[model samples]
Every structure is written in structure tokens, then in C-alpha cells.
Target: MVWIPGGTFEMGSDEFEDSKPVHSVTVNGFWMDEHEVTNAQFAEFVKATGYITDAEKPLKPEDYPDVDPEKLKPGSAVFTPPTHPVSLDNPMLWWEYAYGANWKHPLGATSTIEGKDNEPVVQVSYNDAQAYASWAGKRLPTEAEWEIAARQGKPATIYYWGDSLKPKGQWPANIFQGDFPWQNTAEDGFTGVAPVKSFPPNAYGLYDMEGNVWEWCADFYRPDSYTKNAEINPKGPSSSFDPEEPGAVKRVQRGGSFLCSDQYCIRYKAGSRGKGEVSSGGNNLGFRCVKDK
Candidate 1:
């Protein structure tokens, strides 16, 4: 946990009605990881707690109705860059359904974690990150805390760095710089997920707060909550419909993932967000732990 000297930050965005009434909020001092927890860190947690991630557990046939028992084998999300252009309307243009992908094997059956010692561990669910955080004696940060640390601008700017996406001809963070998903120019020195601290830290010294992988937040997601309430220290919605599950879920994911792009989900900014069932895991989602002071 790294100490963050927090202060008042203007929250939300007026450009979008949901992020309107950009209000100011203050946060006390707290601790946050320098980067998203890496595979090595997750491995340490597993070693200390004998924890098994949900992706490693087999999926029962009933759980995925109509799924082949063999097809239910452990897997994770894998991004297979296309050799040519694909439909812009479809996100699946780059993300493939690998049969045996996981944190250890991000590229499905053919891949292994043989060399990725510092990359942020992907394929982790909200519950998976929570368990690890609990073991580490920390908790996920609230959305307010996350955004405060992701101070790209002087609080009110739409982006963390400034009003300009590419400030002074410099790439602010590690995001896809070429054609989204497919034709990555690797202008950011990476084609897929890069090392944990591959990019420079934010104003608050938080690494990868804008891109890399979406960090799971401890709040429930409420896409419309900001529009309906005060923007000060908003904790997301109390609850919401989770199409990924059978009932309401209570988790918020921020910071955006490598899969995020202007061509697809332009959620790599400080204000971007997404969530999932607590028990579900994907190849692009991971988290970092935070502790209150």
C-alpha cells in the first residue's frame, strides 16, 4: 500500500448527462498498490491461502446451459489480433473464445505464464480479487478514491491528463494507439497487456489508473445513479440488474482494460467503468488492493 496525499477533486462529467454536475469531493489519506496486482502477487496470495480462482474451477453443465461438458473446461479471454480489418460494430473482432485460457495461459491452450512474471494477472473475478485483498489485509477502493487518484486533469478536465487526449505529443498511458483492437501500432511499446508499471504514474502516483486493465472497485454499479444524485463521493448505485448473472450484483470495475478503445468501449479514462458478477472472471479484468488510513 502506497500512501496517497488526497485532496478535493471535481468528480463526474458534464459532457454526458450521467456524469453531469461535476462536483467536488475530498478524500483522506490512504494506501494503494503501485500497479494492478501482478501474476506474481496473485501467486503469492494463492500460495499463502491455497486459493483457487473461479476460472480454474470447472463449470457445471447446468451453470452454462447448453454448454458442452468438455467445452466447459477452464478458459479465459484471449485477444487474437487480426491480420486484416474486421467489422467495427462487433467487439468480438479481436477478442477470441480461447478454450483453455486463464491467468496462467492468457492465449488459451497454446499459451503459458512461462515469462509473464510482472504483467497484471487477468482472468480474475471480483470475488477472486476480494479474497486476495482480504488475505493481503486490504480492500478495494471506492469509486471516489479510485477517481481521486486518477487525477489526470485539475479535477474538472474530462481526461486525467488534460483536455487533449494526446498531450504535447506524448502518450499519457498504455492504451491501444493504432486501429482499436486489431491494428495496434505498438506506439506505446506493447501490443497486448504490458508489464504492471509499464507506463508513467498518474498525478497521485497511481500507475495504470487509466489503462492496462480495469481495476475492480468495491461499489455497486449505477449507470444512472450520478444523474439522479449529488456527485460528491458517490458510491455508485445501491444495486442494478446484472445481465451476466441471475440477480443484482454489487461490484464496480474502473480504469478500463487493454481491450478498451475509442473504436469500441472508450472507457480507458478515469471516468470509464464496467462491472460483472462477483464470481465471474475474464481475461482482461484484474484488480489492485487499497487500504484506508
Candidate 2:
């Protein structure tokens, strides 16, 4: 395991109500994967462990009563643009929970990973990621560790690199450009996820910590928990909640995905955090590995 020497740094922010009172945090040394786990890597894990992703497993009737039995087959979420305007509050407006889509088939029923062996594996649930990490002898980074490394040794700035959204006219991160939802300039060289390590690494040699895809963390999300937390290695709230969802079973996801647009959701910022269903997976979600001494 490659060790990342730990030290003190400011965590969280005062921008959002949840991110109030930025405080110091001292992390102990822990090893972490330089980048997100990729398709090829996961393939090997599956070959060796015969591990089945959540999407591949059949859905129990009790678990998904509303889902059509036929649609319960292996699948993943694929971005589906609305033919007309949609409710921004409801993500299902633009996100289609397609059938026959998984890590192997990212774009619902037809897409395959034939040429994207190096790209970070998508459509992996928290359990799927944990399974892969366990097989690889690693673990997911705590949200604190993720935040510290994402800052890349710099003081907490809005963006990972600096305060400037577009420094010197360079699209440093892979984010949506132009009109968003309706139109993307692809000015960042990519309208969708670029392969892992496609962009320059941060000061700590970590890649894709900002844009590309939202990475999973071990912490249970607490939007307001940061307002009153300890200074050292705070582990977030005991649980999470999303009133929109049926039953609250959400987990923390950091580093906004390619779908993030300033005009829509300005969640691409370093401090901006969101939660995912604990057992969910989508085209714009992936996971990196971490280790503790």
C-alpha cells in the first residue's frame, strides 16, 4: 500500500449552512489508490472472486415492488435528456433508470466496455465498491481524508485548484460547459466522463477528485453535521436522510460528476457535498480505494 503522509489541514466550509466553522483536522497516515478503480481492475476482481455487482443480482419483489419484474433484470442509470423542460428538483426527470445496465454495460441495454478498459468503473453500488476494495485489500476513503487530499495541500478554496473557475481560460476540470442540460459546448474536451487520469493530477498526485464522477466515501453524510464537529478526523453524522427518497438510506458522495453545470447544480465545488442511496449506482458514480495503518 502506498502511504500518504498525513498532517493537519482545514476541513469543511462556512459557505453552506452545513459547512460552517471550518476547523483543523489532523489525519493519520493512510494508503490510498492514486486513482479510481477501473473496469479492467474490476474485471480481474470479478474473474477471481466471481463477485456479482448489485445490478447483476435479481431484485426481490419486496425490495422493488414498484419495479416491473422484467425491468428488474441487470441494469444501471443512464442520462436521458428531456424532450422538454423538466422539474429540476426531481433528478429522475433527466436520469433514466435503464434496464440491462451495470458496470459491464454502462449505457443501459446496449453499451459495453469493450474500449473503455481503463476508464473508472461506473454503476457500482456502495456494496459493490466495498466488495471490490475488500478483494483488492483496500477500503474507501473517509470523507475527511477525501476532502483533505482533494484540497491537495492548499487552503480550502472553492475549486480544487484555486478560486478561479476557469484559470487562464483553461478548463482544468472535466465539467459541463455552456448552456447545460440543453446544450454543452464540450469545451472541456469532454461532454461525458473522460477516461481516468485524463486530466492533470493535483498536488498529491490524485486524479479526478473534482469532476468526472462523484466518488463514494465511507462517511455517512450529514449536511448540517459539519457545523458542529470536532477538529480532528470527524466521521460525519451517525446517519443520513433524503426526504425525497422513500426510506432514508443514503451515503456521502463527493466531487461532482460530469453532469454538474453552473446554471443547474453548482455542486462541483470542493466543499459542495451530496448523498447517494446506499445501494445505488449510476453512470456518473465510481469509487477509489484507501487504506489505514
Candidate topping TM-score? 2
Residue 258, candidate 2: Cα error in Å is 0.8
Instruction: Looking at model 2, report the run of 10 residues with the lowest lDDT sum.
Output: 12-21
lDDT of 2 by residue, 1-293 (tens): 34577889877666665556677788877887888889999999999989889887777777889877876776667887666655677877788878888999888868899999988899999889888888888888888888888887777687888999899989888888876576678998987878988888888888888888889988876666676566677777787755567476877888888888887766778777778887789988999999888
Tens-place lDDT digits, model 1, residues 2-65: 7877777776666554445666777776899989999898888888888888777777887679
Candidate 1 Cα outliers beyond 4 Å, as residue runs: 16-21, 228-234, 242-250
lDDT of model 2, residue 119: 89
Clashes of 1: 5
Q: Evaluate model 2: give its TM-score.
A: 0.93
Q: After superposition, how far is residue 290 of candidate 2 from its true place, in Å?
A: 1.0
Off by over 4 Å in 2: 1-3, 83-87
lDDT score, candidate 1? 0.75
- What TM-score goes with each of the models? 0.89, 0.93
In candidate 1, list every pair of residues with a backbone clash.
13-19, 76-101, 152-160, 152-161, 153-160
